[model samples]
Target: MATARDNILKKIKQALVTKVPVPFSTHTETADLFQPSQKELEIEFAEHFTNLQGRFSFCSNQQELTEQLSQLFSSRKWERIYCIDEQIKDSLILNGMNINPYNDLAGCDASITGCELLVARTGSIFLSNTTSSGRTTSVYAPVHICIAKTSQLVYSLEQALLQLTNKYGNHLPSMLSLATGPSRTADIEKTLVVGVHGPKEVYCFLIDE
Candidate 1:
């Protein structure tokens, strides 16, 4: 006797095998969907990121990046910054910053993280579980500081996804996320609220590589 679950599975399998024709289909399936970007990837990304209320800065070298971060730290007076990447933590510590490389997300003033790729058109930071600064480190902190290289910048999400696939041929990260800007919601009374579910402030430091 066929049960309801079995019948449902059978129907689903049949649907999966059945090919449905589109009522309105374009024969040019391989054509590009969006117009070409007019400006440089970095410039476009910076503009879009700033428009989304995300702070963007460019650093010429590691020394410049350190100097810029130190200045920002003094300005903001961030005492408890959480960073888990050993390389970044070491660099920060060597430059006289007190960066702890342990799991301390609950009481961090800010978090510094590394991204997998950056989407220029969307001004989004693409992250994956493969990095030491995983999903939670980027999302949970009140302030998120993402360090990205100019080489990681791509024109669109599709390009980023393609790069990611090429970078990790057969094995992709278990999880992937895009941080377009700071957390925001307008669920209650239609009033826009930022930092409701995630970081209130987002800063991206683009290093020329």
Candidate 2:
């Protein structure tokens, strides 16, 4: 009288057995994975970032940054620069350089913005919606320029995330982006391409102050 389904169910039930649950603990201690000194982090980040084809520069103060900017602008001949950060704006103004307000990304030669943190392990820059330029500014322009202070550097990605969590708490930004270098792709015929989806050139102005 037992159907195939009934027989299968009975066989499955016969294989079942109750066992005591293993005791579990929520906490576990582990050795630190990243504990590099500040100088080490700076060196590693610069090396990695340069390997990824990113331009890196270190400045000691606002005056040094201004000088660097002047040299860079003169060499690159960037005429239509778009900047959103107030500090960068003021710096440019003080340098007697003209800055264009955000209008269309197509019209800008470069875009300058500030980042939340720089990851030493990966040579990545983290940005969030809370940044002055928001999410699109970095990708929209032909060239992306980041202004980061040395104190904002973290040894690893985990530390960077912890810093963000502590700073934002429950009110975290809507999005967090970590950019390692200029955008690149190799989708067509296995040929490598750069800057298809984002900036072709990425420059970081690292301030020691």
Candidate 3:
């Protein structure tokens, strides 16, 4: 059942995997780097996120995460929700949540999406049009909820690049966005204002799986 095309494709894939160099080694010359533990890293990430113009919250469980967010906006009388097209949409539906996909972000209470990748050091999430079902859903909405997997966390941005290259080969995504917090501007009388062009609230849920 094997054709010449199939054989060649397999060869090419094997070659690429074998030839691609592992850029960094686990061994480090510097011994006193003092890397923080996982708990410390999460705390550091939370601290960095709050320092930005937007308010952020981190949750470990799906039920608690959704409840907390729903309550936050429900208090403000927000009910409609908009979401990007991704795998998480089903999870939301199962939780008795409804999502509007085609409507403009201004019509919804929040936007939810998955990050293309995540950088652990700076607690940043990278979003790309190709990977994240385009950027408008995450960028235009007043509230953005980003769901991330624990396995996707990288030690640094450098490691992220390597993982990306490994996934897509030499050709990279056209737009690689690195988002640490909400969009802000200090234009009016030097007063800080959140959600100028992007989401006012960015909640990150680091899923255990």
Question: What residue runs in model 3 are displaced by over 4 Å at the alpha carbon?
Answer: 1-40, 100-102, 187-190
- How large an RMSD does model 1 have? 3.2
Q: Is candidate 1 or candidate 3 better by TM-score?
A: 1
lDDT per residue as tens, model 1, 77-119: 8878888877888876676765544468978889998889988
| Cα lDDT computed for each candidate against the true fold | 0.86, 0.84, 0.72
Residue pairs with backbone atoms closer than 3 Å in model 1 (clashes)? none
Error of 1 at 165 (Å): 0.4
| Candidate 1 global TM-score | 0.86
Clash count, candidate 2: 0
Q: Return whichever of 1 and 2 wins on TM-score.
A: 1
Please write out the lDDT profile of model 2 over residues 1-209, one tens digit for every residue: 99999999997887775454656432224444767765776788898898999999988887788888878888989877888678779876787766656667678988888999999888999998677377788988999999988899888887888799999999999989998999999999999898999999999999886
**The best candidate in terms of lDDT:** 1
The alpha-carbon lDDT assigned to residue 98 of candidate 3 equals: 56
Off by over 4 Å in 2: 1-29, 34-39, 95-102
What lDDT is obtained when candidate 3 is compared to the true structure? 0.72
Candidate closer to the true structure by lDDT (higher is better), 1 or 3: 1
